[model samples]
Target: EEWMALRIGPVVNLPINHLAELSSKLDPDFPVVAVCNSAYRSSLAVGILQRQGFQNVASLAGGSQAWIDAGLPVYGTETQATVSAAPQRHVHLAERISAADLSRLMQDLPGTFDLVDIRPPQAFAEYALPGSRNAEIADLLSNPGYLTGAGPLVIVDRDGSLAMMIAGILSQKTQRPIKALQGGLD
Candidate 1:
């Protein structure tokens, strides 16, 4: 019963300017509210935009948690997950491709992709896909080596969701197109 209280706005992200742009669509002088899974990411968003000379951008104090804590209404649309309206600074993320397509890419397009397995090495070793190279998402983000190569960088995980989420981050981090394997190994 209490869970139905999530009536809020569409999930939006930023490099500040995009947030401003999205805000401008509403009203050029409208203030931008940046919030993340929590306050930290939102703080970074607001800070970056301000530093970049964007004015009137404010990070939602305490973010969604704060709103929820205050017992505000949340128009939770559980079906709408993942953000599509992000700036160019964000990694362009794709939903997913089938396991069959993945197999084809491996066999047909050799050297075209990296077939990055974002799971831990231990899980990867247990039952890795045909030609996947274990590049844990965290490590890949830090190393930058994983950012190399051409073609579509397909990210894999045990399920589709984690890979999808990581794909967004990886794409943003590398400024390249990265995809998640749909439905993972399941």
Candidate 2:
């Protein structure tokens, strides 16, 4: 009950700009500790503060996970806090495709389209759509050499999720028309 009863000061949960504002109010030599759920966000906060010329800002090493793991109490309400939304980087791809449509696409492959398997290397080696070439999704972002410039590029994965992710990356990387094989290798 004492663990639950213990109350701590409110966490300085604010956007980067607010943190900068707070830093401006404090003496340049004063120390400040940034805390977050897993220290990841706090590490980001530390970077932001340091860039703003706050010379004494530090991130709490273990963060809130360490506090909870140590059996210490959490003082605040579980209600939502104000957080600035970050811009999303990944592209949104189409959802699932039908089995009938997949079969129709397969019959027309190798001539009208280029089948690029976007699954992991190990998975591709085990089993893949016949005549499909391996092009790991990660590699597509870094090395685009394996991709052909000839036909429409169709990305195939074990499931649609990986294919969609690769399609998004490919869309940004090349001028080639990209499409994901719906339902993947299934």
Best by TM-score: 1
Best prediction by lDDT: 1
Tens-place lDDT digits, model 1, residues 1-186: 222434356544343436545543344255767765467877877766665556788777887788878887666646556776766343355658798888887888887887878787889889887777887666866777767666777888888888888777767766556788999876
Query: lDDT at 131 for candidate 1?
Result: 71
Pairs clashing in candidate 2? none
Q: Considering summed lDDT, which 10 consecutive residues are worst modelled in model 1?
A: 1-10
Q: Give the TM-score of candidate 2.
A: 0.43
What are the lDDT figures for the candidates, one per model?
A: 0.71, 0.68
lDDT by residue (97-153, candidate 2, tens digit) is 455655676786546766778777888889977667887556766776635577667
- lDDT for model 1, please: 0.71
Between which residue pairs do clashes occur in model 1? Answer: 5-74, 6-74, 6-75, 6-76, 7-74, 7-75, 8-75, 91-171, 91-172
